[model samples]
Target: MSSQPEQTMETQQQKKKKWEMPDTYVILFSVLLLAVIATYIVPSGSFDREMMDGVERVIPGTYSGVEGNATGFMDIFLALQEGMVQSAGLIFLVLFAGGAFEIVERSGAIKGGILRAVSKTRGKEFWLIATVSVLFALGGAVGAVANSVIPFVAIGVIIARALKLDAIVAVAITFGATFAGFNVGFLNPYTVGIAQSIADIPLFSGMLLRVIAFVVIVSVTILYTWIYAKRVLRDPSKSLVGVLDESQASKEDLRAPFTARHKFILSFVGLSLLFFIFATIQFKWTINHMAAFFIIIGLVSGVIAGMNYNKVAITFLEGCQKLVYGALIIGVARAILIVMENAKILDTAVNALSVPLEGLSPVFAALGMFVANGLLNFLVPSGSGQAMIAMPILTPLADMVGITRQVAVQAYQFGDGFTNSIFPTSGPLMASLAVAGVPWIKWAKWMLPLLLIWVVIAVIMLTIGVLINWGPV
Candidate 1:
């Protein structure tokens, strides 16, 4: 009896679709294009040699600040040409991951597994949320789990609906937890790897300290999410509720049932993880190689999991194709890099901002570092790049304020990780939002309270870490 209404709703939704680009992509591309134009148009040799040298490595001579405004801007176009290959690589990764996830979901493995799993978890909401949250955090820290996590979102959403809970809450729980862990990982490949490379720290050298910090942060995130979910569920007004569009009837379509084929895929995933763990720990392989290894594993899993050979080929291609927008975003973001590097503005900006803070206490200065890093994240979306640009200056400043460089790094991380979900400039956030078919403003309103909660909790944790001298250097 209800089927007709559901069909009608689904049809209406499909017909009334809007074609808006995501805000993050829009902003990223807008900035990138504007920056490219400015880079090519601006003049170089606007500054002295030593000052310009630092900028040049980050960019090129054509875009160096030495050129007069007009010429320097024109030079930026050349830098963009130089950046094409790198930008394409980043885009390919994002797209490939997305497409792979799509194949996994469409294959009935994720859906069937989620349904079977949720049926067993019937009355254990608190524990379920906590466990899932913990897993999410772990995935974030591990990072290579992004491809895995996307499918889990669908699982989380489905489970939430079956349980009569808010789907957004589930989405938040899964993603928020994972990102919290990833961003704050004791040795996140992005931060720790890059930091170690640039700062010359021993590989996996600071394990004990990073482990302690990860435990502390992970515990807090899990606990808080469970408690917060309970409070919100009990009192609707207090909760951040996402509006469900009744017209999106496709969300309610019962997923494909698990067949023997899904079992093969699941087995492959298990074997893949075992290989990844051994490779990472035993072989001491870099995470990059490990990530690439996982991609191959996914390919094998997709095929063995009973994907029609043609479908598998198409999925890989489609996955690569979906990444074009993301690639464009990265390419555009490069424009910002070119402009800042060429104009020699980043260094000047950092120096100008930090010189006045020389007299502050280490704690306050640490806090300032956090704020500065967070602000710059809006402009520089890449965590590795931001850490590189900010840390060099921030570390020296921390030394001046009598704080350890490690503490300075924590502040940078806190700011970097927390804002990614809230920031309109974040690619993942935009991608997730687009997939969910929710408006950003609405999601923001629902998430604003949580964001505030996260900030307060993170700041409190940061204070403890700094005062107690916890965490790796």
Candidate 2:
């Protein structure tokens, strides 16, 4: 009897431990704590910055030691305030986009359109994956489509179920494809544009190479996703989330027919996105403009869907409420950067990393930069923010080492974009997983194989980039 009781107690303890993964907030704050410790250990430094054509450009060879301002425990809370202030535009963008998408979703337009697409692609699931993934890739390549795709996770999951596939396949097809296109982006203004501007290179200068990369990477992603999707489709029990699959099955098919109203709503969103891109390129629109655009689109979309103003208000608030976690995550993630900036060790860390590249050959230099940027992405997940911090240091280092600034940008693109799909600190990735009801640990497991394959491909691309002297040096 004593042994039986001990065995039962041991089993319960094991079960409790099995389900334990640190909460997202805990992980982020823990990183904050480490940043505090780093302030004491790492030297403080900075680069001389100047305004060139209205953008702050870091002058090369200007790094120097600065007085250390190590953060105390009390400063951590103040850093949170600074982080929110810095990330306010991004936070509002998330809120507005979430609200607008919610309005469109309430119109049954997205669901109706998705159902129709699924019906048309029935029995040719591979093609469905290809088509959906490509469209998503195009959006990510040309526009700010990462957060935009969050609303589509439900639609993708629905398609997965209708086709007898699993939620992992749904996430891979949607988030995975977007990430591939983003990393290999031919014209991603958020990453490529910002990096190029910071590097003082002509915007979108090395297009052909990036276009080729985008095609190759996205093709590989589609193929990889389709293979796993096929396996799960063949035997549902083979799914990583097999137990959850059963619960997902009984979800009601709420898909309606794509009506004229739905078409109008989608067209409005599509046109608004086109305007966003044009304004961004021609008029230098920022995140604030994007946020306002989303708010306008939400209100207009609600009116177009024949909703009363009160209903629209309620729906928009509800949508924002749903994504509060995601929006807060943007600010919280920024807190890490705040801590680093205040400590003045960000430049010191960059300088230390760059020291080894001084003697590296061109190809090795490019690869080293790529690896460094990937590691840095863990600290600063925001594309524009990472560009601001890293490109300043890496650009000068690239020229010193015979690597083109364009190649430096390419390395940053690959490093910054690909990691978002896997990193726990990625607000959008974590939010999408939560929306899909997949655990972060489970997503990590399913994503590791693909991540490894992409890393290999990234190495090859960086090698080719260096070999050809991918330029505008």
Candidate 3:
């Protein structure tokens, strides 16, 4: 009787896995196939007429643009190649950061620092989570390099567990806090710089205002994360309510007898911050993205922590290896962008999307920007890339509807940052998911409520940006 109840309970508890592998694969493949057709094979008259007679073809009426002899298969293949080429720099950047983190971790620098830091924090989970969130929020300045915050997350989870708190709650707070900073990214070089530049704003020219806005967003996000973390700690079963797994992280390897190693790591990080602050203040040398800078810090930290040359080299190499899978996924995802660009699918998508809102008032233009940026995020995963592509289009469109270019840029930045932590196709996002071993569906489920919160916040922020007429003329 006892055994029967146990078996029945087990069977009942196992909900059918919602997102099946085959279904996901099929859906992805179908989307890729459609993107290809839309770009290369779609018989558009504009493409045909423009290529043959060059009459400033705004839209392709026929996609037979290359020549009469070019096959549809060859066209799609070329589009894919073009995408890979364009995304090369971005892919390299991601791999570099991953390698650098590997060096820091393998060198025992990260672990040593974590042990010392966690022990010091002790039972102050609230303070610890808040501080970590602030650190990660600065990640936007570095671009996606903020992903290095994963170690902080692991440490936070471990600390929470030691305090008898639910592990998932800790992970959620840590991850959410990091992303909160990432989302606001007051000084994000890739996002803020690109958007401002597109609207002709001097680089970091209005940083004070952005910093204030960023602080507000990050503060609120951290507070909410802390609140949620406490609730889960109070009820372990509820931990997974807005979280992925209660025990996704296996026990981490902690080095014992932490001594001077902690001091070394802190010194390295402290010096790095000093260098950046000095550069930004005195020399006016602005890093294009903060992500790259942090990776460099990690590398330098490893070397200073006594990791041998060979070990450092191998550790960096291992990080590079770790990025390969994510990179491949990126490559596949870029194929979609490639086809879209070659076929001018974005132009078509934008045209169709903008049609309904064309006659709407100036206020609606801001709304349009928000919707467009969010949709474009799905197609172009990189913040800088999307800004480069979308800003050029949105700037002109916004002007036509009495909206300022600055408001458009703000709209783009808000959409780009908000989605980075959740988008399945985002390379770093997948990397985080892989390390955490939380399925994408599970992460999405946990984030849906949070996403709603962010969306509402973003709408309000963008409205403020528009009301204040944010950005350069």
Query: What TM-score does candidate 1 get on C-alpha atoms?
Result: 0.66
A best-first ranking of the candidates according to their lDDT comes to: 2, 3, 1
Off by over 4 Å in 3: 1-32, 39-71, 108-115, 139-154, 186-210, 229-299, 325-348, 361-363, 372-413, 416-449
Per-residue lDDT over 202-306 for candidate 2, one digit per residue giving the tens place of the 0 to 100 score: 656677788888898889889988888888777877788862344455446634679999999989988987777567667766666767888999999999999
Worst 10 residues of 2 by lDDT: 243-252
> What TM-score does prediction 3 earn?
0.67
Q: Estimate, for each residue in 153-241, the C-alpha lDDT of model 3 and write its tens digit.
A: 65655555565565444555556655666665555554665565555545455555556667877777777777767777777567553
What local distance difference test score does each model get?
Answer: 0.59, 0.77, 0.60
lDDT of 2 at 307: 99
Q: Which of 1 and 2 is ahead in TM-score?
A: 2
Best TM-score goes to which candidate?
2
Stretches of model 2 off by over 4 angstroms after superposition: 1-19, 50-54, 135-171, 182-212, 227-255, 373-413, 419-453, 460-473
- In model 1, what is the error at residue 111, expressed in angstroms? 3.7
Q: Rate residue 40 of model 1 by lDDT.
A: 49
Ten residues in a row with the worst lDDT in model 1?
53-62
